[model samples]
Target chain A: MSTSPTARRGNAVGDAWVIARRSLKHIRRQPEMLTDATIQPIMFVLLFAYVFGGAISVPQGGSYKEFLLGGIFAQTIVFGCFGIAIGLATDRSTGAIDRFRTLPIARSAVLTGRALAAVLIGLLPIILMSAAGLVVGWRTHTGVLDVLGGYALMVLFQFAMTWVGILMGSLLSTPQAVQGVAFTVLFPITFLASTFVPVDTLPGVLRTFAEWNPTTSLSGALRAQFGNPDVVAGTSDAWPLQHPVLYTVIWALTIIAICAPLAVRAFNRATGD
Target chain B: MAIEATGLVKRFGDMTAVAGVDLAVKAGSVTAVLGPNGAGKTTMVRMLTTLSQPDTGTITVAGFDVVADPTEVRRRIGYAAQDATVDELLTGRENLIMIGELHHLGRVRAKERAAVLLTQFSLDDAAERVVGKYSGGMRRRLDLAATLVATPEVLFLDEPTTGLDPRARNELWEVLDTLVDSGVTILLTTQYLEEAERLADHILVVDHGRIIASGSARELKRRIGGEQIRAVLRDRSRADDALRLISEATGGEAAFDADADAVVVATAGGAAAVAAVAGALAEAGIEVDELALRAATLDEVFLELTGHSADAAIEEPV
Candidate 1:
């Protein structure tokens, strides 16, 4: 009956894994829960690659279709945040969090399990979008390690986005509100960045904001690592773009550092009432 | 004591949900908190379960201070909220097992416990079906079973059978009876007087976030006075005579219900008073078709204590 501190920590991790498995079970029972992370992103890839590829120009002899892959991947991964937010909000409204809170498990395990599940599910869209990109004549000309690094960066960004999702979810009271606010905020943040177009092509104010945006750094880093086209020859001179990998890593770490604690606090406040 | 709280208070902005309440539940006893909606039953349960902090008060559950050692309290207690809290997408078995695992039971133990609970609650037939497909009663049983996954010594149930049918409610009562017999201390909040009467070893009647009365079911009924001896005559002509005879025999004033052709008298003497009245009526050659002694209902006791019925409390706006 006696438990050491390490044993308790191990139990918390195990509990988190059990909760993550429950989320996976939900996906199994209702595969359509994954449409946002899979079908929607694939649709976006196809729509942009075929419909808008001719109008958009790629720099440094890069094909527009190949250049579009990085942006699409970045935008899709960031959108994964919306899924996590909505899921947590639903759990809150349904009194699931109340049940979880009463258990002896560590409090952080609930959010950790949710974030882990989001990351696991988030990988689907990345893979599906890459497949869709390949079908549309997009190819990664980088070495194997570079391509793997590009994906690792995308997954890391997804993990950071999960914390943001948890923070927003804990702050919001209901699933409907979470969806409404997340879409309103995320749409502009993703679209205004260099996700669908070069930052320089945007208006002056937007260009400045887009250059500093985390989504822009994520896409720029993927483009660099995957050896896709630099977004625009002159726009690439920005400090974030010049050191895209470092900037993206910093953004990811800063988001986790800031939002993780905020999310735990928000969760406690939301459920305490 | 398995659960104890003194001057527990909780507020949401300007409104007080629980206003200076006190409670103590002995080990291996079922203590029922009886109140209508907005009576702060849920708030009190939440604080005791360590789901919410009390605004101003002290609470201890299973020998652990709720505020100072909430994790220790959580480890010793199980709570089944008013809402069914089960994951709808998961099967009944999975929901039970998931809760078991979260309680730190390993996978094998969790599965074994889930199976035992499934059969114990008679949910084995529906074990593999998703909770969304289960009926209301089945969902409630599963929710109760989920809380029992760790075989907690103390159980907190908030309006456990609020929306169940009479049959389902009876079934739940049976399950609770078994748990109480097995020495699990239960502190449940309910609006059903009969539920408290049937299951509670001690009943605390709450009104406006305050404990209005506390005692066993019989003691509560006695607070409003004991049984009422009601006698019905075959002829209305003898109503006055019957009332007079009953008053003289029982030494209590008797009221005649003209519509029902019956004379009613309240008495603390219970069956002896009824016997006295019947003897007097027979000696007077009074023709009586029916005679009965009825104890005061909990509703009347509640009304007498609060100056309002439990029904009226239900109608108050949240």
Candidate 2:
């Protein structure tokens, strides 16, 4: 039997925090979430910055170093989202969440804790990758405050996207389903934008999609903050800078708004011993 | 009330897993739900624990409406699923402590309760070991400990000892008995008749999503029809003679146990028939070794109600 939302466990924030602490404990013991979170972002930064950066030339005399860090930063945190989906799916399959359904703690604790931990985990990778990028000749012309804000902004994007992945995981039938869904959703979302290539170079149709894509907005705004050289282009290029960080925040909010409730609904339906 | 449900109904698509059923479990009693697999015993336990919802029933657990006040019900009740659920990465102590936290116990209280429960369940030795490394019995005990960390007023244990070795099963029984003695109302489901016979103050036999029988162990056992007498003869030659006398006394078929050197017969007149059989055996000069009269066990009661032999009830198609 389902109670109304008001009838669920005590305060959602209070419950979410308790859940977050428990999740942090789980992460500490397994250590894999931390390792994966750390390793994933590094791989994204290294693979793209060195291998493909040379071919993608910008009119601003793009030093592959200056050109790639912002996009790679976005990739680093976004990649961390997969861990959220996989972890949640694993917990569901193992009956952990089923057991939680009978507990008095807040109902949102399970997913919220996971999403929050993924954000914390993403922070480690962001720092590690940023350090690694700096060592690799990557440049960010933004001031100290801008750098800190940009990093914090990246973590928030990871947090929002983690919930999206969690929504997918909680709703899917299996972990393998999460794998397929995560890739099918994430790969296109990350790639159709300018993660590796400049968006302007693509065909008219794909270029329009890329320019409008949330991912490009995220990377573009970050790039703008870091003072990465930009080329003056058509109407689409202008949109990425109008509200520098607006697009990323809008995207993050949109995902959290839609997926958070869906996740809560899906998890609430998991009524079993 | 520990558990109160009216018109409890649960459905999964075309199939109704738990039909419209009513159940009430008084506080501080061990109520066993007995049934074969697919009989809704698990479903009923699930609903009582607030794990599943009946499509058309009102359920109040520990004085809170389950549909409208699940969090309160959960706070007051502890549930251990039929399948053991534990975090493999966490030690038994950690699992119990986490559950205590979920139940909103304070840090010190959670640890105190965890330590007490681990020792009570005889899982203290393995408290620090990861659950994935523990034996099935230990894991089951740990799961129970996790459920009990909050000292809930109601406890729901589903198929509590389904996969335990005999020694482990007995150990769990003692633990359960102690918990029940402490005034914890327990609602359990089990396919093991002996479990029900040993632990339940009241037994609920459910089948095909409905309650078929409900009573105390003694009352249910007495409903199995008649007393049984088993007589062991010294020689095979006396089997025919014994059969003749036993059939006349029992007014039914006489079953011979050649392996145990025994013949089991049922007699309606119980003690009088035993005296008559003893006299007939003495007159026939057939020495009997092991002559015993036994009341019906829960196994026998199960057979009588379900219409299957107690020994061969677990048959499956090849």
Which pairs clash inside model 2? A1-B53, B9-B55
Error of 2 at A62 (Å): 3.0
The global C-alpha lDDT for each of the candidates, from Candidate 1 onward, is 0.87, 0.77
TM-score of each: 0.94, 0.89
- Model 1 off-target regions past 4 Å? A1-10, B315-318
C-alpha RMSD over true interface residues, model 2: 6.0
Writing each residue's lDDT as its tens digit, candidate 2 over A159-208 gives 78887777777787577888887788778878887766677777988887
Candidate 2 chain A minimal-lDDT segment of 10 residues: A1-10
A27-87 in candidate 1: lDDT tens per residue?
6677667677678888999899888888887655678888888889998888788878878
Instruction: Sort candidate 1 into its docking category.
Output: medium
lDDT of 1 by residue, B178-235 (tens): 8878888999989889889988999999888899899999999988796798998998
Per-residue CA lDDT of model 2 for B44-111, tens digit only, reads 87777777777888998888898787778887777898778888888898888777766666667778
Instruction: Provide the DockQ value for model 2.
Output: 0.45
> Weakest 10 consecutive residues, lDDT, candidate 1 chain B?
B309-318
